[model samples]
Target: MNQKPVNLFNTFQLGNLHLPHRVIMAPMTRSRTAQPGDIPTDLMAKYYAQRASAGLIITEATQISQQGKGYSFTPGIHTPKHIDGWRKVTKAVHQAGGRIFLQLWHVGRMSHESFHANGQPVAPSAIQPDARVWIADGNSAGQMLDCPTPRELAINEIKAIINDFRQGAANAIAAGFDGVEIHGANGYLIDQFLRRTSNKRTDIYGGDIPNRVRFLEEVVETVVAEVGKERTGIRLAPYITQRGMNDPEAIDAILYAARKLDRMGIAYIHLVEADWDDAPVIPESFRRDLRDSFSGAIIVAGNYTAAKGEAIIDADLADLVAYGRWFLANPDLPYRLQHDLELNEMKERATLFGGDAEGYTDYPDCQEKAS
Candidate 1:
């Protein structure tokens, strides 16, 4: 370990990316996109562009297709307008000197029936997890609606989703993203397939670890084909057991997937650890195992302070530490951390989702607060 002061402000390189610092802005779903079509807005661009000092900015989880969506007001990368909307965001971020990656997402069984065409969500199996999805209209505030039993996807449908992912990556590139990230974490579609609790399939897409990981492999393969391996990344949460997804098999499957991604030469593998107070502790031994498995850059995100993030970097556990809520509230997060400045608190809880610029872009930068 090259241990000459490993800290958050240290410069780092991720493939062709030469980051000025190690602090990365974690992807968070604020649900503030333009309504009806769920397109990215200029305000969203300003919001992202404000935090351009981070090493990289992973955009909020974006649906690849209408069927892939589980929540309202979350942006999409499937349509021309969506691409145009995101183009503005990318340009803003780039102009402000920031590198960003678009996160491709599909909700699977973690969706409500209202978002589906056949009055049912889609999953690896027909089982309904004890979870709820965020649903909102143009009227009142959003509420969590119970996720219903989903229809198991046919093998052919699975291939079509692979195509959807490929197209989504291409669209992300078109939208001027520096790279693309596949959302395989947080009990979503890919996580559902990787875990045993939700995926009880008899076909080739289930049973053993290899079979269950077929969907993720194919998706990564198609995405790599579309946008090259160097520009592709993935996020995985081996520890999360939310929404009835408490599968012990995920540990091995995720490890296997990490090594496979390394073999495929994917740019990075983002590991999402637990965030809440009662969240289970991820052992340092597993972190070492993961580091040995994947050669690419690793980013660990959860609830983390500067000291905690620095300690991980010094211990050679992760290359970068991502901050979610802190970055959301502080536009000049990197500056604040760099100078040990007092942080601003998040003010608009009611308008965090599906709102105007009031809560989204109105958060002041560090200099403004100091002034």
Candidate 2:
């Protein structure tokens, strides 16, 4: 007799937290933080609280330091004000009975000069990525600006950034976050160090696969030291080739890092597959290899529908499924998906980035719409 297949709504034990279901709310940067200081606002708190039914809500990429910032109006975790601001968000989420994780990020070369005081973004090497980051205009509207050639970071700067990750983890705990997810994907600073296309250094942190993965290992070790391995997760994008991130050896390097992360006993490894309409499919062999390499939980995100999510979980390829755009529009995403209810369509593309409650908190749930 065959065993029952795993359902999408099945309860999952992810590290120390016991999730109610397997539907995770993936991280999406909405550039809605308070200006001048990049602090979380009451509106952001309400927005997160509205979607508290998710198994886990991984917050939008939050900069760990001022230098980690790339896009405008994105929140930071480096300052007293930021911590206080995030406390409000955490309190609201907890009151609403939700678990949240802050995604620690540093954009590296995927940044413009305007965000830096010296007008130079820092990266593992001086390579320039063909990427554009959103910078808000005078009217608070955002524009995608091209990134410039970034300055290569010194050995000391790399160490400092690792410490920044450690501090960011500590600050997230102080702000009452359940955990932290290191943004090691999508051509960010950590991703830059992992790929040969971006990192062209001769130091110990460059060259072979082991050297390339050293920076990521160090960052993870430091964060785990700060807030235990159980509360730490990481995101990796092996199939993503956009924004000058098409590294041929990226898969091997990520797998090598996954082995190390498995030994380190981190909570989960979130893989971001390419999501474009015509994006290449991730090979099944890679998935099996990844599962073999990492014994902990695995979360997969990239335009996954409810059926597709259940299929992956049933196949034992991934433990949890994260919905990004779907969760953005449907605050009660899990309920709707579980009950086969109609989802609220996303409205006003302009409001997706740096706007107010029009597109953020005003989306009605199934009950609200019925009433």
Candidate 3:
């Protein structure tokens, strides 16, 4: 008995987001925002509009506030000017008949003092990651400076940051985004608190799994209060060990969070797989556990080829699959996949970040490729 082939072009309804297909575009940092205030530009709008074929396009991780910023040139949702800038982006995407979600981001310990009001980056504890973040410089891809030790956030400061996230979500709505996706993954602020490796706090925000997940719970609750749960989603990485974050119990802790989020009725949970080669494989048992715990749509993104994604969706492991680098190079990715067309390889490694139209907006579509 032969089963019919699973189709990546199948339609999926994610919360209030009506999609044309299941080929979602995962968020990637291009570091090309307009300078002076880290605002989204017409160039950025064009870049997103070009990829309107995606079922859902999650914008690059955007700083929720000035203190939330970690990298160079990433957009923000903290001010009137920022909202105006994002308005252009959302307008562009909507006009192209696409739905886009702005990912609210805060770097936490994966930051440098230069980005802070005071000369200290705040985190769950005084510890820091052994990694670097991109900063503005004359260098093509910007300069990667080592992260410094951070100051532990006071309980008052933690409460303020939660308000920042809530305001950010409200601003995303004002900016005309279809919704907001909380950046709780990739060893960023939320991930910093979720794991025990970086968070050494003795306060209510750390210690046991329930305590560690407290900040996440508050942030989500606030954001969902600002924008309905159906319009809010979160990204999480249960197996990633980057940025000196190796949480021994991350898998279980995240599954617990998943159950909680399911009970909250959020839009979806994007599972970010480690992007590096030879990354840890999230076992099938874990996937099954996650599926059972979270009743909402599950979006998995990693080294997914079309066939691999189709297989995962067919198995009912995930409702949708996201593509990052491949979607960047191939703007008409869904069309290519639907017609079995060859994809364009990445333009140039040098043009991936902090570049101009060459790599950002010049990726040819299938029609152009045919010519």
Candidate 4:
């Protein structure tokens, strides 16, 4: 019989980095990091290595500094221990023939005092949103708590956060990552700073759209300086409205920013369509605008299947498709796509956020059956 068609194995490139397939693994918060300000652990290395067949794997959002943390048990890239932990992860993934990128992040006002290093939450503005964050204590299972009022960031302090991102990129390089991806999404510090609803400031970091985007631009430049433009990537959830964060001109703003990054020669622009499964459609005009504006690879994520992912790539709207939840239940997701095999059901929602080895590294692979 003739071989079945599988667009999942289609090769692509982000700048000079050639990928064997277009199945990019979406960044996920596994919350398995070691205690007292979540540091990457041996389990993380094993977890990532198991999923290394992904054309590219973007690690869970890693806090760049202590203030960057919003939840307990999430990994950080600030401390020496964190870098050492991630070094093992990168080595494992590399040995498995996978490419990985470290996503630099800061939660800003989305955090509570419990997760902070200085016992205070920081934000672009002093406003508090109706959002909940997960908290963890040894022996007492994780629970969701309401977000607290945040302190407004000073101009100088804002500059310091930019420097922190630069330091994070440096640490990521030391950790042996192939590249760094800026987490300017999901109501984090950069997204909080960029969104007009969350950011009500009079400084240069706020005001007009360009001004709101200044912090992200500075961060991109900082990381590019450390790792060079060819190895830099950015993850944006522009359409997702969580924690009262909204950008009326999100598409325009990000596309405009994409043009700038393209001109600067940044690697990829990974866009998360929405927070939920039934995400709103991105207009053809807008998709084309992004395609025309950005010369580098474009990766789109948010509950997409192999067929829909292939359709997007075939239409030239995206260069690659990122699998979020599907990648969680299926380790050999690319192989499954190649063979058109049935995907495992993901019925356990509570098992996602915080856990030990179960429900995480326990996901069986397709290769196991073949053997």
- Highest lDDT: which candidate? 2
- In the order shown, the candidates' Cα RMSDs to the true structure are 2.3, 2.2, 1.9, 2.0
What would the per-residue lDDT of candidate 1 be over residues 220-319, giving only the tens digit for each residue? 9999999999889899998998888899888899999988899999988998999889998899888999999999989999998888888999898999
- Count of clashing residue pairs in every prediction: 0, 0, 0, 0
Clashing pairs in 4: none
- The top-ranked prediction according to TM-score is 2
- Candidate 3 vs candidate 4: the TM-score winner is 3
Full-model lDDT for every candidate: 0.89, 0.94, 0.90, 0.85
Off by over 4 Å in 2: 1-6
Regions of model 4 farther than 4 Å from truth: 1-5, 275-278, 369-371
Per-residue lDDT, model 2, residue 334, is 92
Residue 298 error, candidate 1, Å: 0.8
Cα-based lDDT at residue 68, candidate 4: 84
**lDDT of residue 27 for candidate 3:** 96
Can you give the lDDT of residue 198 in candidate 4? 87
Error of 1 at 340 (Å): 0.9
Candidate 1 regions exceeding 4 Å error are: 1-6
